[model samples]
Target: MHKNAFAIHGDIVWSKNPKELQTVEGGYLIVVDGISKGVYPQIPAEYQGITVVDRTGMLVIPGMSDIHVHAPQYGFRGLGMDLELLDWLNTHTFPEESKYANPEYAWRAYQIFSDDLLHSATTRAVVFGTMHVDATMTLMGKLETTGLKTMVGKVNMDRNSPDYLCEKDAATALEDTKKWLDEVEDSHFENTKPILTPRFTPTCSDELMEGLGKLRAERDLPLQSHLSENLSEIDWVKGLCPWSTCYGQTYEHFGQLAGDQPVIMAHCNWCPDNEVEILKENNVFVAHCPQSNAQLSSGIAPIRHYMDLGMNVGIGTDVAGGATLSMFRAMADAVAVSKLRWRLVDQNLAALSTEEAFYLATVGGGKVFGKVGSFDEGYEVDALVLDDSQIKTPLELTLAERLERYVYLAEEGGRIVEKYVAGRRVL
Candidate 1:
């Protein structure tokens, strides 16, 4: 065995596909230099001398991924749940995000959010920061210290935003974004990097979007933003850009949906067929924020349809809008909302199963980062050691049943005993 090789023995469970989950009862998962070596029934002879951490009774699963979350909104999570999408943003989101301009407030708030994220089941995330460059950098620095891999974006909004939060103009927005990216490039971050965020079509003028697209091409950075999330928002976009055929087309026309770049668009709840084709053509990833959609009265996304059409999909908390940071909550919400959609919205579609929901929370979402959220060989070893002993059950339960129970019932506390990012124990 290599000197750095180590193993953890537990009840291992992970998704093999949306329909199948691979389970190993009392198996040994080997790790060598932060890469998964594979799972074995027992420690192999070649690895016999290596260190083995015996987590006999715990359930070991791949770490969850949150593809869409707003780090600035973490401070106000669980509030303003009664409002609709546009109203909620005007009332809650923009106001709270505006506060990030204050360096001290940003540091304190981001530190708290980062600490919670480090302790939570999420090992990887794509997070949104506010328009303030220093504050966004502060959030990045705090998250970097937690040993989690993340992509943080400094938001760009030059129009249709509160005066306090909006940038002066497109040139100023691009200049600030360039400065932020240059700083990130020079810092040599190991697990964290920069993403380009144009708040959305409504807030981002065509000029600003065009400039951001150029910046993305120059830096070869990923992009993230909202999509057709609500009816009112869609109408507003149409009013703002009358010449565009659809909201997705507005992005494509501006080069924001460049074919060579990776983009994650949140709340694709109301995407039309043509827009769906555009998403598919560009191979764009959808961040399905189920709980946030429900909370904000946004319609349920056709996740089943997306799957049937072979579109890339992932789950996200979308905090404040989602009311919780738990990807387990996101999974349960995905399954529950899909049931509603299947029964009432579209009888032709099938409801999401526990296995599928689990897949979205792990493997499906992990694809955005590549080769994560699974125990396959040559994959990074981001995992969680979960102890569900607190849940009382009269009969002995299978590992799958236990996982389902944890997904639906685990509350806000320390159910996660340990968290690992790339084979390094971070918690």
Candidate 2:
């Protein structure tokens, strides 16, 4: 056992429930052996021997998880922002994604991705890598050193993609994925793992989808893909898999959807009844990329409805599509989109609140991967210590209110003073 026990003393803030928030003004977290043991108002006499770090007035919150992001496209964020989904994919996305064939390009691109993510207050992420296996492998290596809990995906696309970007065939794609997995088997990614990433229905043939699904079951790895993101994309899915019920069913028909394996589908901005039921039935997690949806002109997702149905969901930065890696901004955008969605879609489901958004960014989707996401007792000690020493907020503001305000408007400099993963400070 390690003798280096640790504790964080600060003004702690975190969720108490899905709908409620909590704060302890003079709270401290006891991180025993890299896992949280308990939170307290003062150090207990029995545990006085452990080392403690004092933050005085800084806010300590659970580290965030980004459920969907593209590692290769991190550099292209905010460019080509005016185009909608299909046009955007052909113009900016495919062109940029094709450059990964050169391992040198991968290093340059992924270095920006890894470094930005390292400092962005996101301690856990589900990331998409470009289709080139070698380039994707390079990304996995860089991510391992960042100390974030990540699922790095090697993207698959066999049809209707650019000549330079698409895979040669199903067999080659699967083999490439296998090779990447094999190489990483000994790399000790720590908390990072490889996932199956099919680039949506139109890009994958039936054969490739089925092969990946089987591999998922055999290895128990998670699946990440786009779902109902845009009108044209959904139409393309219907045309390709006409026998299926809806966009989600295309994956379901080929044994690709879910059984015991984990599936995270991004941008469910337009899922229908059967699709939502399929998600609920199989326990699939929805990765809500609000800024991406807004930027790509994909309609607002019915997030309030999903929460009403008790579906698990989380916020994602979505990088080039969404624009920023700051989970703080993503949380604010999530609430903004949900309020817009509530006005247009359905008013019955509660509009998104700050508590719900922050909770989703932390513990909600982290539950999909296990033992990650929160400072809850027995949870991993992945957390962020904010340096708000210079902020001039009115002293009357509650810590939770101050946190909510920070999420809406704080720049990267003020909020993330130091980042921690499993009780060890990384930055």
Q: Return the TM-score for each candidate structure.
A: 0.98, 0.97
**Which numbered prediction scores highest in TM-score against the true structure?**
1
Candidate 2: worst 10 consecutive residues by lDDT?
387-396
Q: Report the alpha-carbon TM-score of model 2 versus the true structure.
A: 0.97
**Model 2 Cα lDDT, one tens digit per residue, 303-395:** 878887989888888888988898888999999988887787778766789999999999887776677777778888888998765566557
**Winning model by lDDT:** 1
- Collision count for each candidate, in order: 0, 0
Model 2 stretches astray by more than 4 angstroms:
none
Q: lDDT of all predictions, in order shown?
A: 0.91, 0.86
